[model samples]
Target: MKIFNLFIFLFFVTTLSNAQEAKQDFYKRSFIAYEGCEDSKDLERCYEISFHEFLAKHINRKALKDSIFFEAKKDTITVSASILYDENGKVVKRHSRISNPASNRIEGLEYLLDSIPTVKPVLDKKNNGVALSTRKLFGFYLNKAKDTIVPIFGYTPSEVPYEIIEKVPVYKGCDESMSNEDLKNCMNDKVVQLISENFRTNLAIKHNLKPGIQRIYVMFKIDKKGRVKDIVARGPHPEIEKEAIRVIKKIPRLKKPGYQRGKPVIVPFSIPIVFAVSD
Candidate 1:
């Protein structure tokens, strides 16, 4: 009995380790696939990147809603949703279960689930497309006044797999007529040019900063209205960080917002800027 139990434990451990490794490999492969294809001028590659980006942004954003809490009188509610995707990657079926159900609240949850964008089928080891399913949980709580619903927590069973956008957000004056991949490259080139033009390179010399390649990380969100917001930057020096933020804030409104399933959605973007300086 001891020997058998030991074998079972070892098997479980091995299986768990293998699963973890496989998950990591999948992410690595996904990153490589995106990076490899992102710059290609091919339409198919551009479309693939755009499709994945839309899926990632749309599904994650629409999966939770606080409005449902406002419609319900209940102090708390929990909902579970299952989304079924067809081989073609469209949502063919959806079902939801509400605990402590109220008619209005249930209706709201149902509507939200139905609005989820059509899923894209993931490829199997054989490179064959297969249907997929995912489950999500949403919790809502009533505010102190009990007059409005507030979303307390939203959870999805699996991380939504999304690739970095094949096309970066388009800036004003950048040619939009180019292919998606070319458009992204153009946007990047323009941003770099703007940074080079606007960045206070003299600040480094004044501060006696060492000569090296300085990297700044910036994060921002493009809202459904096509406006940039929540710009944040961090870098090796305060001057660099400040200048990065200032330049990013000056970005003009996008001609169009990112869309998923034909609906506009908020897309968060992050980029790293490297500046080379010489003594």
Candidate 2:
């Protein structure tokens, strides 16, 4: 298996506001008045960054350690949520659906939401605080090795690129004591080898794909714990894509997670796999 350039888009519904005037001009749209973002030149981006930072800091990670959401070797948890603010800029209502129904009633989440501070609501052209309703996508990565739950906020949260991260994730069997460059090379080689060994090439013939090179774009995140999560793939055929995901998911947990500036960070990766089909 040969690996090539990769790109990842953390697709999620970040902003779903009911402000009617926003349709007129996107750049002029009013953003929620998160503290310290009121004077930002780019208000929307600032709000997103500030909001994600708040969640990551205040979400009470330790309380989630024993939650059912992280059970059964689960590496990622996602939530589809709506937060409503009254004209007074208070969080009056909040609704969320977790990825796992078994953990539907999350106490940690309830406490976190309750702790959210009342920010200045987004104002309309009239300069009046407008009642607001917005939907958000939230996620959490389980670092099993450290027994920690890292909160992931907003759509497309900042993820360190592979080439730039201080230390790339090491595969389970790779020698971790090696230099960073060697470790990265070893990890990439291990990934290619794992995919080639596990991927079901016969699926291509079954799907009757054309007798040529078929490219499957695989995207995933290697979390702080070095576990594979959020695997997504696009290919010529649905079955082919499914097989690609299966092969990637089968990868064993890595020995070490990537680090940046002395702290572990989530790393996003995408790989182009060339699958050949035969008549």
Candidate 3:
């Protein structure tokens, strides 16, 4: 069935090249932390990078208690996930959910213990910035699935279609549901669409891509100013990788920038985008 080339390679460039870029050269390194095309979390990381602001735009919890909560609890912190591939590791579909336990930590910090009546607090935020629950929960993993070589285009690799598998979950995190102000502020520009298009066109032109299927993973940042700042990739591919990076570099700033208690800050990105042959 031709496998419908939904090409989304992660990132793979030397550290030396990245260190040489300018602060303004943010888009150039859009997907670095997410190299090696490890798993679905990598893709989710790319989404986090490319659309952090957009996603953050989605997170609005009226009360911390009512923040996005998971349906089930796990001994460790990892969303249930699955990778669809052949017997080898040639990836077909990489699927996963978002996860982070940092937000889940509430009971262990010593400073907050005094707030409770029954017990004398033994912990200290300075000494124990984390809760005991936080101690056991690890919300992320660094490419647990490691491999040196990968199947390049028309070649076969050792892990071709290996069905790389894991049992993470569809856990939900804090909600960033949009507000009237958020909708109004963002609608004037429809920033995500513009960014997506800019990258798409850049890929088609600069990369000399045709009407065939291509996969790409895009990464970028939404600084506190709401501007999409730094971007990089984490894995590799053929010409598609080059074009994907080029496209992300062209997106204009969305909102001026976001703020945390009224200050501009730099957020990082590690998102992935996919390109498929158009009909």
Strongest candidate by lDDT: 2
- Candidate 2 residue runs with Cα over 4 Å from true position: 1-158
Listed per model in order, the count of residue pairs whose N, CA or C atoms clash below 3 Å is: 2, 0, 60
TM-score winner among the candidates? Answer: 2
The reply for model 3, stretches above 4 Å from the true place, is 1-192, 199-214, 224-227, 234-238
* Model 3 C-alpha lDDT per residue in residues 225-270, reported as the tens digit of each score: 4454456554334555655556656555544333322344343333
Candidate 2 lDDT = 0.63
Q: What is the lDDT of residue 146 in candidate 1?
A: 32
Every model: Cα RMSD to truth: 17.9, 13.1, 22.1
Worst 10 residues of 2 by lDDT: 3-12
The sequence of per-residue lDDT tens digits that candidate 2 reaches over residues 1-279 is 332222222221222344543543432336577788778876656765665566657655455565655564557654434566677778774432222223445555655666667877777666777776654445567677776657665333234556445566788888988766667667777778877677766666566666656688888998988899999999998987898898889889888888755677787777888655544
Q: Which lDDT value does model 3 have at 118? A: 23
| lDDT, residue 264, model 2 | 73
Off by over 4 Å in 1: 1-169, 175-178
For candidate 3, the TM-score is 0.30
For residue 93, model 1's alpha carbon misses the true position, in angstroms, by: 29
